[model samples]
Target: MEQLTTSLDVMFILLGAILVLFMHAGFAFLEVGTVQHKNQVNALVKIMTDLGVSTVAYFFIGYGVAYGVFLGFNLDGQLTQAMTEKSGYELVKFFFLMTFAAAIPAIVSGGIAERARFYPVLLATFLTVAFIYPFFEGMAWNGNLGMQSWLETSYGAPFHDFAGSIVVHAVGGWIALAAIIVLGSRTGRYDSNGNMRHVYPPSSIPFLALGAWILSVGWFGFNVMSAQAIEGIQGLVAMNSLMAMVGGIIAATFVGDKDPGFIHNGPLAGLVAICAGSDVVSPLGALVIGLVAGALFVKAFTWTQKNLKIDDVLGVWPLHGLCGVWGAIAVGIFGSTALGGLGGVSMMSQILGTLAGVAVALIGGFLVYILVDKLMGLRMSDEDQYEGADLSIHKIHANPPKEEF
Candidate 1:
């Protein structure tokens, strides 16, 4: 029974890792369909390569930094066979965690697309996955530096993020915010006097919608698989995820006034927000959370673009950053037993944890980008910008489509 159980656990986590890994395609296609045709190829290449670079960084440094386990090292500080009694559950777990770590760069890639140079962006990704992201991840997930203890002592219940609402999504979104500010708005995104310019329409609605669909489907795995063990999986997590998704879609549809782009992105915002409390919040609570997140994304996206003059190409900051914060804090409200949730959370802890995440993201993200900018520069020249990223960086258009009949 023990042998069989270990195998089952390994298989369960391996499946989850595969599912989250598939989300990368969703990310790629989403970006590819959103950017102008001229930059479409660059978007695809960026996601694919970011995952590649992130994998290398995480395997070599990020994983060790976050977990503090060096493969074969035992308590006595002596080497042992890599495979042990758990039958290599630790190795499979690394694969799962790496997918989450890689997502940090994938999220930032969309925010800074088109104008930024390729190599510099990759360098930043390497640094973020290898050091900055892992540092906060260690604090939040692994209890590094006794932060979770501090939160538990001061507040209550130790900042309950069952599935990385703040750790991954919020962290990604906040980091993207820093990169966007450092990179600045794409050329002509604003005027000399800081006025809004023409809004660029998406290259293909079909592809954009397709990307959204893929992400929505894969999210089931992302949320459900976070349980990490077959016995740990709960039907409530699945239920909350579904309710929040529909709520986001319905809310975005109405709030965006039936805009297809907003409608498609609506579900994503909801899912991102619900990730924190899906395991605990009621279905009704999940719906409300989704609705608010959907509406909030639209409002925040517009605010960032027009008011703050930040050009987050895919609105990642609003969808991931702000909504992520909302999700984490929502745990206090929605995850409480009084609201028909599982309880074991408090408002103060949520707030402090969210703030700590944002602080780390801003500080780490800015420092990495600043150093990279000074070293190799971040954005392409004006000439490259006008030429578009596909031609400028990749030396090819997305698809010439050969002349029509």
Candidate 2:
């Protein structure tokens, strides 16, 4: 029975890891569809490379920092124990979590697309995955540095993020925002007087929609399999994810004035918002959260582009950062028994935790980008930007012309 149970657990988490790993393709396609025609190849290449870099960083440093397991030493001993008594559960768990860690750079890639130098961005990916992201991840998830203890002592409960709303999505979003600011607008994106000179539309709405659909489907595994064990799985998490996704779609369609980008991104906004409280919130509360997140993405994305001049190509700050914060906070409001939820959360704790995550992300993001900028520069030159990253950096276009015979 013990052997059977262990095998089942390993298989469950391994499947989840594979599903989340596939979401990287979603991230790549989303960016590819959103970026300009000439930059699409770079977008695809950047996400894949960032994943490779993030995996190495996490395997060496990030996982140990967050969970205190050094895989380097005693590798044979660890593997022997893992395969025999533990059924390799720990190894598969690392795979599952590494996918989450890698998502940080994938998110940042969308924001910094079009003009970022390739190697510098990879360097930034290593720094954040190896140090910055895991630091907060340790605090929130692993109770490292006594942060979770302090929160529970003062606020009555530890910060309740069933999944990584603040930890992964918000951190990625804020980091992307900082990188975008440091890299500045893509060449001709703005004019001398700070007026918007050009509007860059999505290169392929179909691809964008496809990416969103892939993410939405894989999110079931992202949220439900977060239980990490077969015994801990809950149908509630799956149902809530579904409700939130539907709500986001309806709200975005109504609020975005029929814009396809807004419509496609709506479900993602909702999923981001519901990640924190998916296990605790009622389906109705999840729906409300999704609705708010969807509308918020549309409004915030528009406002930031027009007024703040952030120039985030995919509105990552809105979809991930802002919606992620809302998701964490909504746990306090909607996860209460008073609101037909499972309860055991407080708004104060959520606020403090969310603020801590944002602070870490912003400071760490700026620091990484600044250091990389000083060391090797962050952005491509104007000439490179005008030529687009596809040809300038990768030496290939997304769509090549036929040869003239």
Candidate 3:
């Protein structure tokens, strides 16, 4: 029986890891499709760099900080054996965490696209995934000081994020925000008159659509695979994820001015919004949350661009950060034992906890980005911006123009 449990846990974790891994391709295509032709290769480079950095950093330190050091489970006490006895599981956890590490920085690329220096972005990715993110993941999920106190004193159940709304998506969003502030807008994203210019991505609509579908598929593992134990409502998590995505698609497609972009972004928003409570929310609740998330995402993106003067190259802030916040709070509002038989801390308390998580993420992200900007210079030169990052940085030409003949 014990072996069976262990096998199931490993299988679920592996499945989730694979799902999250696929999101890389999703991000690659999505980002490349959303940016200008001049910046497409730069976007691809960032994604690929993030993949390498995530794998290495998470294995070395991030995994331990997130699930090992912070969990406070002494193998010496539990197994009466040396630390070597636990190295295998620890390694597995590290691989799992690499996906998350990769994801946060991938979010940042969209915010700083077209002008950010490649090496600087790489440095920022390392710092974020290795140190900045691990701190929050430790506190929130690893039963460290924050989760322990919340669970013991406030009756919270270990800061129940079935996947990672606040942990991964929101953290990534906050980092992206900071990077944008430091890196500034693209060369012509905002004009001398302080009016924002619309810079269309160089890729086709089909690319964005395909990327969205890939993300939707990957999200099943991102949410359900976190169940870790088959008995721990893995099926419920999967169901909620599916229902919310559908609801998000429906709302995104028809809710706005019938914009296809909004429709395309809906599933991503829905996935982010439902991430926090995927294991606990009922299918109906997930649907409602997804719909709200989809609508809110469209509104937030439009508002941020039109009113706030904040330019997100691929709309990462709306789809991930803002929607992630909504999903985190949704746990507080709809997380009831009776609703789906998966309850954690009280809804109100979870709300506070979610806010606290956001606070930590935002503050940490800001500080890290500021330091990176100061130390290494985050953005490229004006000449580089005009010439395009692909040519200036990589000395590569844009995709050859189609031949009319």
Best model per lDDT? 2
For model 3, the local distance difference test gives: 0.78
Per-residue C-alpha lDDT of model 1 across residues 100-131, encoded as one tens digit per residue = 99999999988998899999999999999999
Cα TM-score of candidate 2 = 0.98
Compared with the true structure, what per-residue lDDT tens digits does model 2 show for residues 1-405? 988988999999999999999999999999988999999999999999999999989988898899887554535575456555687788898899999999999999988888899999999999999999999999999999998899899999889898888999999999999999999998888888878899998999999988998898988889999999999999999999999998899999999989999999999999999999999999999999999999999999999998999989999999999999999999999999999999889889999999999999999999999999999999899999999999999899899998999
Candidate 1, which segments miss by more than 4 Å at Cα? Answer: 71-85, 401-405
lDDT of 3 by residue, 324-369 (tens): 9899888866777776535664665566667767777678778877
- Per-residue error at 259 for model 1, in Å? 0.7
lDDT of each: 0.90, 0.92, 0.78
Number of clashing residue pairs, candidate 2: 0
User: Worst ten-residue run, lDDT, model 1?
Assistant: 72-81
- Steric collisions counted per model: 0, 0, 3
RMSD over all Cα atoms, model 2: 1.2
Question: Clash pairs of candidate 1?
Answer: none
Off by over 4 Å in 2: 73-80
User: Highest TM-score among the candidates is held by which one?
Assistant: 2
RMSD of each: 2.0, 1.2, 3.5
Model 3: lDDT of residue 152 = 47
